[model samples]
Target: MKRKLLKFLNRMVLSIVIVVAAIALIVVLFVQFSPQFGGKASKEAIESYKNSKNYKDGVFKNTKDVKLDMSLKDMGKALMGFFKSQPNTKPEHDLPSTKIDSLNIANYKGDTRLVWFGHSTFLLQTQGKTILIDPMLSSVPAPHPTLGSKRFSQELPITIEQLPKIDAVLISHDHYDHLDYESIKALKDKVGHFYMPLGVGAHLLEWKVDKNKITELDWWEETTFNDFKFVCTPAQHFSGRGLSDRAKTLWSSWVIQSKNDNIFFSGDSGYADHFKTIGEKYGPFDFAMIECGQYNEMWPDIHMFPEETVQAGLDVNAKKVMPIHWGAFKLAMHTWTDPVERFIKASKKEKINVIVPKIGDLIYINSLEENEGYKFWFEGLD
Candidate 1:
């Protein structure tokens, strides 16, 4: 009996050692190849970023100035809190079978049609022009395919090859999720122009996107493409895909103004006074697509909470608001359904107009009240 016990113990120890060694090897391999591993921001851009007054004081005066509340212990406690909570009671989403070919761009009329292609990716079509925003078509939101957060659903409503002639590509930042390598590679030879925040053109240049096609804008700067004006507005957030390069690139929200209407795309932002300032500069937006999920108290200054999202929409003077940044990935500790539910409640209280569309549903900003048949996508979840 003693000899049998000794043999079992030896086998268990060997198994443990093998597992540890395999994990260590995988980590080393990943670190060596992943773009997020150690890509450096251009020294010139970094210096310019540091010298900027926006970088010196930060975006949000109240919260951005405060130190982070997160630590290893706090993370551990938050993980424990998640496990202690009850299992998800929300019913699974039985999304309809999406037919990409059936999605006709012409059906949207002269008004802008905004299609949520999961997470931050969106298909924006207006006045016969189609634009893709943060076109991340990859299944995972990491530098490597096997590493990071995977998509909750299949590919978006339409594949890159099937997309209409892209007039322009708008990028808010250069995070792997927002500016995917594979997606950019596919779009490189296809799209005509790319608009991005200042210093973010480095990543695109590295990816071989035409330098002439890329237009980088600083805060409050505006550029015209044909008849549309794209303005880079302030957002309360930092940028960096890796540890060493945080805040090296500027982050921004975009205000797109066409001949007849104005649309606001709150790329990804925390709550801040910039919203009011942006409203004053570009007031009464016809439609506003605001970030409304993947938030937590530990990083409150970098992401807006649910209630704050509504306030942001109001502050931006949006005629109609659509909550985004949720329904794609579980990036925070909150229950997956919390963002939409909270947003609905808050918007109702604030008397704000909101439209909650499904993953592939296209919403026409001008016809929001007319097209009241938008399916309650979060019905079962709530």
Candidate 2:
């Protein structure tokens, strides 16, 4: 009997080993072949980034020491919270959205009009140029469609097919939510140029974006497209799409300046002195899209809360601000409307102008005053 038991135990152990090895092989193959995981920086791309002050020890660094990992206790809390059925993490039903006409974009002459496409994605029309910022338009933000939750709003303001040809797409970092593979694949042929921080062009190159069309920049680096000067500025954020690639690519905020107007796009950031510095260098912005959601006390140094979003606007000397990084995904524990509700409450205290547009509503930058009195669009929704 003892001999029989020993033989059975050995077989069980071997079976377990085989199962584990198969799982490991599957993961390796997926990462290798999946287009959604995106491309990494080639040796040449890494070599070109060697001179950047922020690129050190073979990875990008933030200006200040920021926490990129969570503590064990916080991790436990996050894991437990994930399965605890927290209420209101997402909207109860499909939210409202407006659709735009393709004809309007083809014949566009605008004073820097902006449209918020749910989360951080925006369609900016300025000086006859249509640019997309952090265009992660796919339903699920995960590497695979089955790996993530669908966005709260089931519809987009405009489908990718309906979009007029794009002049450029500006990326701030390589986080899956901000940089999506499917979105880029759909847009690569339609876009003229792609601007991003250092080391991000490799992903585009792998996705078949022409190398000539990709321009990568380090912090404070500036490039021009048509009537605008695109400056890659600093942000207090870490980046990666996978477990191992953290900080391999740089993250940044952006300054878009035309001869007549200036705008700021805070890709993703924690509150830091960089905002004030950006304001000093490219202050007095006509408008700013400030990140204001997916924030938590667990990882406080990476994303900003609502009050901090308001202050960042003031720090950047923005005349009018639109709170973004919310209105779509349930990335944190906060309620669906928490970011905007808190942002408006805080903005009133500072008397900072807030531009709250329904998803897809047009924002004319030349006259922001006309954009006010937007109804609290999320109040009635569950």
Best by lDDT: 2
Q: Rate the local accuracy (lDDT) of all candidates.
A: 0.77, 0.90
Q: Write the per-residue lDDT of candidate 2 for residues 213-315, one digit (tens) a residue.
A: 9999999999889889999999999988776788999999999999888999999999999999999999999999999999999989999999999999999
* Every model's TM-score: 0.84, 0.96
Error of 2 at 375 (Å): 1.6
State residue 340's C-alpha deviation in candidate 2, in Å. Answer: 0.9
Q: 1-382 in candidate 1: lDDT tens per residue?
A: 9999999999999999999999989777776676443344476766666555565532212224644447998789767754565444222553332545534753444677777887788888887788889898888778776656466676578787777567899999877768888888887887989999877888887777778998988888899998899999988877776544566677889999998789999988889999999999998899888998888777888789989999999999998888888777656677777888898888888888888888887677777792253356666653
Model 1 lDDT at residue 77: 73
**Candidate 1 deviant stretches above 4 angstroms:** 1-29, 35-39, 47-51, 56-69, 78-86, 89-97, 102-109, 370-374
Tell how far residue 201 is off in model 1, in angstroms: 1.3
Candidate 1, residue 234: the lDDT equals: 88
